[model samples]
Structure formats: C-alpha cells, structure tokens
Target chain A: MNDTRQFHLLAGLATGRDARSDDAIYQSLWEAIVEHRLSPGARLPEDALAGAFGVSRTMIRRVLQRLALEQLVTLRTHRGAQITSPTPSEARDVFRARRLLEGALLTEVVGNIKPADLQALAQIADQEHHASREQAIRLSARFHTRLMAMAGNASLSEALSQLISRTSLIIAVYGRGQAGCPCEHHTLIKLLETHDLAALQKWMHEHLTGIEASLDFTASGDALPDFEHLFGHHREQNAS
Target chain B: MNDTRQFHLLAGLATGRDARSDDAIYQSLWEAIVEHRLSPGARLPEDALAGAFGVSRTMIRRVLQRLALEQLVTLRTHRGAQITSPTPSEARDVFRARRLLEGALLTEVVGNIKPADLQALAQIADQEHHASREQAIRLSARFHTRLMAMAGNASLSEALSQLISRTSLIIAVYGRGQAGCPCEHHTLIKLLETHDLAALQKWMHEHLTGIEASLDFTASGDALPDFEHLFGHHREQNAS
Candidate 1:
C-alpha cells in the first residue's frame, strides 16, 4: 500500500491560504483522521499537506506540530510525518490514563454541575438524538468537553482534551474506529440530572472502560477501520 | 528602569552556538528567573538573547516558545517577549488547579510507590538538606516530578509539570520569590514512607493550600523582590 496515498487522495484541490485558517486546516485534518478518511500510516509530507490544505509549508508545519504534540503524528527527521501507529502497550497506556483522569474528573463534575449546565447537557443530547450518526458521534465527543468545561478545572479539561485526541489516534490504529457511539452520554447526563454523584462517577469509569474494551488490541494486525463511517462524513464539506 | 537591561546585563559573554545548547540556555534562564536574578517583567529581546546565549535566532525563539508555553514568558505579536506578570486571578487559578491534581495524584502515588522509589525520595530530601537554599528549592520542585514519575501517569505528570512552572512564575510575579522552601517535600516523603495514604492525601491538599496562602496577591505594584536573598546567592554561577 502507498503510505501517502490515503492522505493524497483525500487532499482535494485546495488552492491558496486567503480563506483557510490553520485552525480550519487542523480541524479538517483532525476530522479526517478520527473519522478514518485519512487512515493510519498515512504520510503527511509538507508539500503535499501544504497543497492539500491550501497553506504554506510553515502553516502545514504548525498543524503537524500540534498533531505531533498530541502524538497523533510522528514527525521523523527526513521521513516527514505519518499518523501514529500506537503499539499495543501504548494503546493500553492511553486508555489507562483516560480512565484515571476521567474517573477522577467526574466526582467534581457531578458535585459542581448546576441546573443550567444540566439543561445545556440535555440540549446536547437532543442535538445528538436528532442528528445523523456522524453528527451524533461528534456531539458525543463534544459532550465530554462540555462536561469538562463545567467541571471548572482548566488543567483537567486540557489534559483530558489532549488524551481524547490521542485516544482517537489509538482507535484509528488499534481499536475498532467506532469511537463516537452515543452510549454513555445519556447515562451520565441522567445521573447528573438526578445529582447522583457516586453513580455518575461509576458510570464515567465504565464508559471509559467500555470505550477501551471496544479496541481489539489483543489481536495483532495493522488493520484499517473504514474511515468514512468511523468519524463522520463531514470531510467533503470541510476539505477546502 | 530599562526594560531589557535586567536580562541584558545578566546575559553573559557566550561565544557561539557550539558552546551552548537550548536546554542549557533554558535551564540557565529558568534558574535565573526562579532564583530572582531576572525579575518579573524583564524584556527578552531576540537579538540580545541570541547574542548572549550564542545561539541562532531560531534557537532563541525555540527557547522563548518553551518558556512562553510554560507561561513564564509572554510573546506579544510585535512587542517581542517579556517575563510574564500573571494577574492575581491567574495566580489563583494555577493554585486551584495544582491543589486538585496534586491531591488526586497522591492517592495513586502512594499506591504505586516502590521501595527504590521511596529511597530516591529520601535521597532527594537529603540533597535538599545539604544544598544551598536555591539548589534545595530546585530539588524540592524536582521532588514533585519524581513523585509523579513514580505515579507513572505521563499525562498527569506532564499536566502537573506545566502547572508547576506556571506556579513558579506566579510566585515570581505575585508571591515572594522565596517559593521553594523545603516545607512539604520531607513531610510528604515521610507520609509516603509510612504508606499513610489518607494523611498523604490530606497533607498534599494542605501543602498546596499552605503554599497558596504564602503568596501576597492583593498587594499593589510590581516591585522587584530583591532577587538574590529571596531566591539564593546562586546567580553568579547562573546569570549567563
């Protein structure tokens, strides 16, 4: 398989920087990778990425660096960059860390969640319920962020956000890529509504464990989960 | 006060790039600020810094970017960079975050501590006992990393490290520069030594609160807390 082919074909015909922000490029790339439109081991060559995103190499580098910082990409010296293929051990570590943090995060999130925040959360669930599967997935991921923001600890939220990106990469590389399923959001949301802090915390832990269990890290193979369906189908609109 | 003079005067006669690395430069600069030789609001012009550190403008920018990332420096668009003067609210936010993470971190650390790790903690305390106050301060700060490293969560440790650096900058700006008193380290080490998880956790909370209470955030004006005595007499070796 051509390592760069998936990213190259997905690049589309973006031309010029006037309209595309690094953030837009970053989000599109982020969506593409998580959704599996851009598969694991896909090359992120600067020139190709620059042309693909309608930005300069410097701009592309900025995006790549951010991805690299989060371990979504491995920027090699002369080898350019590729989506991270986490080893089985690394896959386990990422999930372990996630469970530790999110489990701890929920105690405070539940204790501190106000009625207005609960209503906003119900609104998120409504949006997820009404939206397409892909949008549901995106909303589900955003649900966690909303919870974190409400938790009111910038440090924990920031840490978990980075871990979530890494978890997406892990799912891309190791887990089945059905990462955004809306299974646990409502359970926690309902728990929060009733002010059941203990169960909310317990539910949060199980939710993360469930996510980890979905990854087939026990079996050894570099299989590509289908991209278009895993994350969402927003790329056609997002690909500049 | 010449804005650049503090850093400029502290910039030693570094000859060329071959003589120094960015890490070395960063450590020197870190020690200088934490030790109070380079006061808050000190200007860090690229050329002067480049000349002083004997590195490329790119190298200097890399170092500055790191310090900026750690919230020790503020990189304005065209105004260049200055050591950050964190507002009182930012100061409080940092401590609040620190208290949450550290308290959470202690439970895991105590559960995971190995005999060798305990010995290493003792050794760190011993070094602090014998070293100069500045070195003791540095060691005390490092003791936290060692504890977190043993906790074995890279995500949590990484988050706390960034918070610690920001906390140091907060202390530099709002608290006395004497931020590294060896107050909490040995006590926590003792608690960990005895495997007292509950006390360890409680101590970590009070430890952080005690540190926060030590800062004088409500007082007005940006007076340079006389750098030498506040931190230590370590600058002659570190000023460059």
Candidate 2:
C-alpha cells in the first residue's frame, strides 16, 4: 500500500538472494506490481528502489527501462517512473487478445498435455487456494502462462506473458473486489485433464470472458497528464 | 554486406533528417535489418554506428537495447551487438505463431473491413510489385501489420508486429531465393474486399504455410556460438 510495505514485499521475493541481479530486481518489482502491493500510478523513485535492492542506480535504471518496454512501468522525460495504470481501452485490448490467443492455444495444450504437465498445473492451482491475495493473483498468472507454454510456441508464450502481467494492472485498476481468477483456474485444469478440445477451448473462452465482464471500466478516468512536470524543465531552460 | 554498405542504407533511411533521434536511428537500423540489407549475424559496432548516425554511442546503445528486447538484435556482454539469426526451430516457432495469430486476426479484419482500409492495403501491395527485393520484403511485412491493425486490438497488433519483424529475421536466415510474401498479399487484399471470413482464414493459413515451406531449415546449422568471444571478458579480468 505504501512504498515501505511495497519494498518489504519485494524483499520477501528477494529473500535468500544476496547479489540482486537485474533479473532478480526485475522479478521482485514485477511481482510487487502484479500482486497489487505496488498499486498503479505509484511512483518508483530511482534512489528508493536502488537503496531497497542494494543495487546501483544504473542497475535499477536498466530494470526500469525493461519494465517500461513491457508497459508495466511508465517512464516520463522528467517525471520519473511509475507503475502503469492501464486505460479502459487497453484493458479491453488485453482481454480480447487473451481470449483469441489463449483460446486457440488451448487446443495445442489439449493435444499434447502430458500427465506431468497436468500435475504441475494442478499443483499451482492448489497452491493458489492458500496463497495470500497478492500471491494468489501471481499464481493465477503463472497458471495461465504455464498452461499456454504447453502449446510450445515461444513467441506466443512470451507475448502472452506480457499480456498476463498487464492483466494484473487492469484488475488492480478496474476490479471491484473481484479476484483475477478465483476458482476458475482449477476448473480449467480439470478440463485439461478431460482432453476434450471443444470443452477446453470453450472453458478458456468463457473464463477470459468472465474475467473481462467483471471489470468496471466506467469507474476510472484516464489519468490527466502532468503538464507542469512535463514542461517544467523546458521552462527552466528558457528562463535561464 | 560490408558495414559501409549497411551504414549507407541506414543513411538513406535517415535522409533529410539532421537530428538522428533514438526512434529515427532505430527505424533506420530496423529497416536495414528487416530488409536484408543487414544480414543475419552482421556485427553492429557502436563506434561505427555512432559515427554513421551522428549520434552518441549512448543513444545508439539505447536503440540497440530496444532492438535486443524485441529479439531482432542479440547483444552479448563483451561481443557487442549483432543481427539475430533465428534458428531452424525458432523459424518453425515463428511460422506456427503467425498461422495461429494471423489466421485468427483475419476473421476480425473481415468482420470490420472497410472500402478505404482495403484500398490502403491494396496500395501497399501495389507498391510491392514495383519495389526492389529488399523494399518489397519490408512492404510485405508492412501489409500484414497494417491489415492486422484493422482488427482493432492494439495488444495483438503490437505483439504481431514484433513477430512480423522477427519473421523478417527468420526469412533472412533461412530463405532460399524466396520473397517474404511475394504476391500473396494482393490476394489477401482481394479477400478483404470480398469479406469472406472463411476464405480469408483459409487463405491466411495456406499463405503462411507456403512461406514456411519455402524456407530451407535443413540447410543451415545453428551458428556455433563464439565461446571465446563469450568468455573473453571474464578471462581478461582473471588475467588482470
């Protein structure tokens, strides 16, 4: 909720890791964002993050740049970085993409799902039942990403992973006390075990559809641009 | 091709542009790479590129970092950056991803096809006919990306754009005297005019299949990674 609490969550994700590499920092920050510990529009000060992670500002800058590219973070010229708040249109785009991509990918997953794969997925679903709210949401994303990876297309998997991460941001912004997946992931796991292609695809479709339907798009207006912060440096240079 | 020739093509792309900003430099280098003017595994030295583009090496590094994120360029720790050479398996993955994503997206294009959209697509296809080989390949990628944009999903459009760019890399790697899309984009344009969803989907599937078929996957082995180049910095540190 606050920066200190958010950094604590990141520390938990980074526990037992002494030397925080780029990936470790990125993963910790990403988890905190997707888990809603770091709410949308929360500023990510370079010094704060660098101090929290015991890394240099250069390392934090690299991680921030990567996250900015993935759209989970927004970096302005002079305004610094913040967790991205997905617009209503971007939310719709993410859901539509998930349905079209995840639904189609389920067929490949159904065709080639091994028993071990099913077990691994079920384990994640089971873990979600006891996870904290943040952990549950992250696990939900992990479930979908892991399931889709069965289709074995690295490009789709990678792209969907980004969408999945953004879906967390969307849920944080528009969700009215609703979970990202709740119990639906377990049911989808069951459908995978059944191996009915039609059933699996149908469930995947309705599952994504149901999640999209639950979001309250009208609740949030687009964040007004900070024109002062945007042009303050230009004004200073001109005055000088 | 030589670095001089590659930089010349980049210069042409950057023509009439004095301020070679990051996007300008990125666009020029991206065009060169996708157009096959910059071959797979071509080294992109920072000093040479900075001199050619008249930008700081820092700016060039940022652009290269972006391309590296998109998988168009590979940046090693000590080896600097080079154009990505997608492997046989990676090529197959790209084709499969295209068939699934593009085939699904065409249905949306058919559902929302407009006369003007079709005309615009036709214009790109028309230009492809008269363009040189490199220009034609870039135009063909543009046509597919443009058509998919009509589906009205920014997430899918952005994801597909990355895949389309990588497809250019794939084609450069394994193409055996073949064009990226040749003349099939025109047929796709015609189908969009007709608004036949089923036909459009089928045509897309076969069109992608044909492109994948034309690639000579068996002809090239994965580039034996330069191990000495990979670990050269570590060895130098130890010796020091």
Candidate 3:
C-alpha cells in the first residue's frame, strides 16, 4: 500500500508519457524520501540505486536531476545524490516565492471560477478538514493544487504544484502541523463563495503566513558545499 | 563556431550539471527554433534527432521533455514532438504570467540592490543598447536575467528565465525586431541607478507592455487539439 501510494505521486508527473516504468522509478525514489525511508541527509549512490531499480546509472541520474531541480534531492560531487534538507534561508525563500505566486494565482483565478470548479474545490476542502493529520496535510496541499489548476495555464499549474511539493517537504522536517485548522480552510471557502477578492487575499496571506510561522527555522542546516564544486573558482567572482 | 556559440545559451541551463553533451543537445534544438531555421509548426522527430545528436532516444527524449516544459516543444501522441506554436490564448497567458513574475522579481530584488550589481547590470544594458539587432534582443533578455539573479533564489531565477525564453520565442515568431530601442534600456537603467522603486515598477510595466504590444497575436496559431488527448475526456468537463 505504501509503495503503491508513493507511485501515485510519481504518476502525477508522468500521466501522459509512454514511460510508466521510468516514471515509477522516479516516483519510487521520490516517495522514499517523502516517507522518510530515505533520511534527510543520506547520500544516494547511483550504482546501488541503478542495480536496485534494474535500470542504468544514466536512468537513475535522470531521476536524480529532476528531483534536484525540485530541490527535493541535492546532487553532490563524486558524492552522488542526497535527499535535500533545505537550509533555513532556502526554506524562507521558497515560502516567500510561494506566497507571492499563490497570491498572484488567487487574484488571477478568483475572478473566473465556475460553479462546478467551486463545488469540486469545496469537496477538497472538506477532505482537507476531516482527514487524519498526515492525510490532512496532503489534502491541504491538494487544495492549493486544485486552486492553481483552475487558472488554465499548464506551465503555471506545474510551477505552482512543484512549489507546493517542496513546501510539503519543508514542512515535513520543520513543521508544526498542529498550527493548521479546518477553520482556516472553511473561511477561505466562504470568501471564495462570496467572490470577495479582498477578503480572499487577506485570508490567503494570513493563512500562508501562519504556515510559515509554524516552521522551526532555527534548525541547523545540513547542506554540502556542492555549489562551489558545480561552478568552480570563477563562480564566486561572478556572484551578484 | 556555430556549435560553440549555441552552448553559450545552454550554459544558462547547465551551470550546475556535469553533462555538457545533454546541455549541448538542448541548446542546439532551442537555437534552431530561435534562428527560424525551424519554423513554428515544424515537427521534431525523436528518432531523427537521436541519430543527429548521436545520442540514445532516451537522451533525446529527455531534451525534448525539457523543451516541452518550456513550451518551446509540444509533445504529441503517435505524432511525436513538434515546435509549439502557442495559440493567442496561450501567448497572452504566458505574457500575463511573465509580467506578474518579473514584476515580483523586481520588487523582491530592488530593496537588496548593490552598487556592484548595478554596475554589472549597466554593462549588460550597454550591450543591449549598442549590439546588432539580433545580439541586442539576446542582450535585452540577458538584462532581465541578470536583474533576477540579484534576487538570489535559484529556482525563482530559473523559473523566470524559462518564462522569458518562451516569451522570446513568442516574440520571434510574431515580433517586429525594430520595435525595441536603446532608449528603453537606458530608461530602465536610470530608474535602477536611482533606486526609484515606483518609477522602476512603472518603467518595467510599460516596457513589458510595449514588448507585448509588438507581438502579432493575430497570427493564427497552429496548435493541435492534443490537450484533449493528453488530459483525456474529463479535461473539458473541468475546464475553466
């Protein structure tokens, strides 16, 4: 059940392509991290993973690269790959960008929402409110995904969803999930139902801020000095 | 010389990765379209490209997927991938998103601007102003990139850069290259040099609006009805 559930997330990334097995492998590795099977600072050796997944190192590296772009996996020199543990600074930046993005998305979509879309969103809100703590977090993330999907831009949808995914990982290590409540989702729905844009903006800003506040940013970082190796000596000189 | 020149663009995407070959392949395809050697509606067959690049279908597919993500390539079922000719709606949506994102990037970085960053940016502005029309367009795009990099969020910079890349393609197929002028770049630099956020915001909005105005959105789009194929029967039901 656990393995299958994890493949489900990978399937989201690979629905239409003719590469189900490859997608499965990518998601499997991703899921391992999501489930904490792959611990936060542990290195992912290409040879072992390639053998385990019955694929070439090239295939494993492909998945690792995709994950790295999402900031979920950090690829290191000679060191192979590791489950990314974002530094406090990185985490705050992600949250700030998401806040800006989600705010823009909400402003864009709230004006054009259809009745059926609202109905579906309401159902997701209900699921988010009633689900178990772990499931609730996933459902809550899905709420934002559903909202972004309504904007009708493929790239925007993908970008916002990836940000949500990374935010979930951030919350996993630094979260105080207890800070979230169904009342927050309900109020958002109410504002949406009324089509009150100002209220909607206020609610979302507060909601996102509350989430950001819940993260324990004081945790010490566990990042490798991979950027220096990736760019070499000249990168520092060129740094803005 | 041509091959070497193309890698310069790919270097933007591959600054951190170890795979020069993969980056080269991606930029080659990108430049082909950029130079109008491949028309907007041209098909990019995987097998032919794999042979041309002397790489596996997997490698070629990876490059194609990344391009598709950038909206430069459209992946079609049974028909393989083709260069994406975004519809008026898609083009407008992209411009809208870019306006929001670049505006946000400007807002985020304006408070943090340094003298050195401004000086380096002034060099890019000069390049944009004095270069040949072709090189000037590239430099103008680079100016925006250098501006965003100052914000210090790798993901945000990449996401915004990819959006700018797509916007460049949109302009290439539909633009009047003569529409851009040095006065605009100088105005932006003047605003930046003074740290006048309000004027900076106004100049960027008008600047982007001018670029968007130059595009012939009336150019009939050559998009396939492949969204239905990719999303299945229910996409229309849920369509916003």
Candidate 4:
C-alpha cells in the first residue's frame, strides 16, 4: 500500500510538472471561450482566477493581457477584463478581413502543400465532420487556422490566429444553426493537391462567404449570461 | 499683459493637454520605432516612463502592451519590455507577407478607386516628390499606407499600418541608404487612375519588390543613439 501510494504521488507530480503555467492558463481560457463555457462579456477577475488555477495573479494578468491583445477579451480601465462581444459591424469587418487575409494565405500555400499536409488537413476535416460536441467548433476553426500556419509566414499566421479567435467570438455571440454538409474541406484539399491555385482561391473565398452568410447578426442582449454562473468557479474558490 | 498671459496660458494648455499620454503614446512609440528612435533590446521601464509622461503605471503598461501586440516590442516576465529586433529571416518573411496581402488589396481596390481618390493619391505622390528631409520619408511611407486605407477595410488598414511601422524599424536598423527615385509611385498612381487593374497589381508587386531590393540591411548598432535621443526628452523631464 505504501509503494502504490508513492507511485501515485510521483505520477501525479510528473503530470502536473508537464503543464507549464502560462500555456495551461492560455489553453484553458481559450477552450472556455471557444466552448462557450465562458460566455461573452463575462468578466475575468485576476485574483479569483489565480486562486482557481493555482498560480499567481501576475500569470493570469499576463494571459488576460495577451487575450486582450488578440481582441478575444476587452481590458477596460478599472472595470477589469471581459470576453469581447463584437458588434455586428465589427463581425462583418472581421469576416471581410478574414476573406482578404486567408484568401491570400490559401493562394500562397496551395501550390506548396505536400501530400502529408493535405492528409493532415483531411484528418481535421474528418474530425470536424464527426465531432458531436463543442470540440467540433474548435476543430472547424482550426481547419482554417492550420491552413494559415502551413503558409509558414509567422506574421501572417499570428494575425490570422487573432482574426480566427475573434471570428470564434463572433460566432459564439451571433451564430445561427445553419449547419450544412461538411464536404467543402475535402473539395478544398483536392483543389490544393491538384495545384489549382485559381480554383483554390475561389473555393476559399466562397467558403468564407458561405460561413458569413450563415451567421445570425440580429441577436442582441440575449448574448450575455449572468456573471455569477459564468464566473461561478472563481466565486466559489474565493468563498472557500 | 493680461491678454498676452491668457494667450500664453492657452498655448501652454494646448501643449500640455496634447502632451504624451496613453492615447498618444502608441503612435509616438510607433513613430520612434519606425524612425529608429528605439533600438531593439532597449529596456522600457514603467516607473521611469510613467513619471516622464505624467501618467499612471497603468497607462504606460497599456501602451507597452499595445506595442508588444504589434510585434514592435517584446515583453518579458521580469526583464521588462524591449523593442523587437526581428531577425533577418523574419524581415524576409515580413516582406513576403506584405507582397501577398498588399498585392491582393491592390487587385481588389484598383477597379473600385474613385476619380477623386485617385487624384488625392496622385497629389500625395506629387508632395512626396517635392518633400525634403523627414517629410520625404514620411510621405513615402504614407503613399503605401494611404493606398491600403483606401481599400476600405479597417482591419487590413490596421495590419498594414503595423507592417509599415515594423518595416520602418527594420530599415532604420539595417538600411544602407540605397534610396531610389520616386518614379514608382507616379507609375502606380497613373495605373490606378487609368483603371488598369492588371497593371496596377503588377506595379504594386514590383514596387514592393523594388523597396525590398533597395534595403541596406548592413548597418549595425545604428539604432542606439536614435532611440536614446528620441526618448531623451522624457528622461530629461523626469530628471528635472
């Protein structure tokens, strides 16, 4: 019994040690936002968050600052941080910018894609198609993100990443259940593998247009959940 | 004497009111970075800057965070912030991304240019041709920035603004003064005015290529004094 307990303790330590503080926080917050676990306009209190994450407020502040920079969170003076809730006009602008930036990225990387990259993208598409839970949304978002990454331009990739995050925010606030068939990804991969730059560009543009057209921008105040439920974990920990 | 004092007071108020704050710091810092006033690896101390700007540490932190988001500055855990000195490879990647994004912007906006907007762009080129000293460089940079702005996408405009600022930083650090004639701007304006979309796109690609080819990229340690003098006023104010 003593040996088993010691082994369990060592295993837990190893698993905990593998998680870098910042990355873990970033990933958790990102997932929370993407999964709608943390709703739009929900405040992220640094001290409470620090307590929940078993880290310092400084780390939470740093991660929140990074999120603010990405426009995923809005950092206001004295009021603290909240998940960004993009206005309708801002949403339209986000998609328009994505069309331009992602279109260019697709055009550049289409001709350069290796068979392995195409296969990897196909796998993402497959996962996105079969995904029943919230992971589907993230996988769907990552599909375009991975394409931008494959372009191998760090600046463009970083910009696209921010745009994609904001896009997810917009979707969370305004998305309608206009789900359709998921064959667009396969078609895109085929076009890319065939080295058809013009077709790839057209398909990518249409893909974004289709996604934007599917959004419901009319919803307003119904977007924000009450602060208590959204941030209950922090409140509970603080109370404790 | 009363009138004169009031006038002096108003002027002083205007100057003091317009004095650098968080609202203005980002642009000022951007200018400094582009103009090589801030060298890569130079530390930005919050207390020192807050005292200099007559603002709180919060405001300084906000501005530095903005700069870091633009990749113009790097923020470390305990080491404070420093101007980003991108590697040569990063510089190349910046240009490549510019080519793709700006090229697409040119293609899309060429056909949509209003006659008045074209005339305004031509006027800018005319001013650039006659500009002396820093006005010339400022005008030259504005020529490209204005074109992107005219594309009617705020997100693209913002991204391009950051790119231009970074390019200026790169030039200040590595440029060898291989300045060329300003004919390309004239030609680009002519193509746009003539509604030659294909030619406009081609000219833009060539223009960016020409600018890249003209970069000196050989200067070493030229950024130190530039940054020192640029922020020296703030230092002196604090010291006094």
> How many backbone clashes are present in model 1?
2
lDDT of 3 by residue, A1-240 (tens): 113332334334434443346567776666556544565777777766665555577777777877886778887767778888877777887888888888888887887789888888789878866666655666677778888888777667777777777776777668754635566777777788888788887888888888888888655445545565567778767874
Reported per model, the fraction of native interface contacts reproduced equals 0.29, 0.86, 0.29, 0.75
* Ten-residue region with minimum lDDT total, candidate 4 chain B: B1-10
Q: Model 4 lDDT vs. the true structure?
A: 0.73
User: What are the per-residue Cα lDDT tens digits for candidate 4 across B1-240?
Assistant: 112221222223223653465656666556555545556767677766665555677777878887888888888879889888776677888889888888888766875788778787788889877866445565677778888877777777777777777776676556676543467788887777787777777887887787788776655443344667568899899999
CA lDDT, every model vs. true structure: 0.71, 0.86, 0.72, 0.73
Q: Give the TM-score of candidate 3.
A: 0.78
Clashing pairs in 4: B37-B227, B174-B217, B176-B216
Query: Over the stretch B5-122, how does candidate 3's per-residue lDDT look in tens digits?
Result: 3233433443444344766878767766654556577777666666555566788888887787677888876788887776767777777877888787788678889989889888
The TM-score, computed over Cα atoms with residue i paired to residue i, of candidate 2 is: 0.89
| Each model's Cα RMSD | 11.4, 7.9, 7.8, 12.8
Model number 1 iRMSD: 2.4
**Alpha-carbon error at B75 in model 4, in Å?**
3.3
- In the range A1-240, model 1's lDDT, one tens digit per residue, is 323344544454233344477667788787676555666787777876776555578778777877776677788877899888777777776677777777776767777878888888878977887877545655666677788778677756777787777776676666664545564567777777787777877787778788778878755534466466656658866875
What stretches of model 4 exceed 4 Å from their correct place?
A1-20, A55-58, A178-183, A221-240, B1-20, B41-48, B55-58, B76-78, B111-135, B179-191, B217-240
Q: Number of clashes in model 4? A: 3
Better of 3 and 4 by lDDT: 4
Q: Against the true structure, what is each candidate's TM-score? A: 0.80, 0.89, 0.78, 0.75
Q: Report the lDDT tens digits of candidate 2 across residue range A23-97.
A: 889989888888888899999988778767877778888889999999999999889999999998899999999
Q: What is the per-residue lDDT of model 4 for residues A33-53, given as tens digits with 9 covering 90 to 100?
A: 776667688877776666556
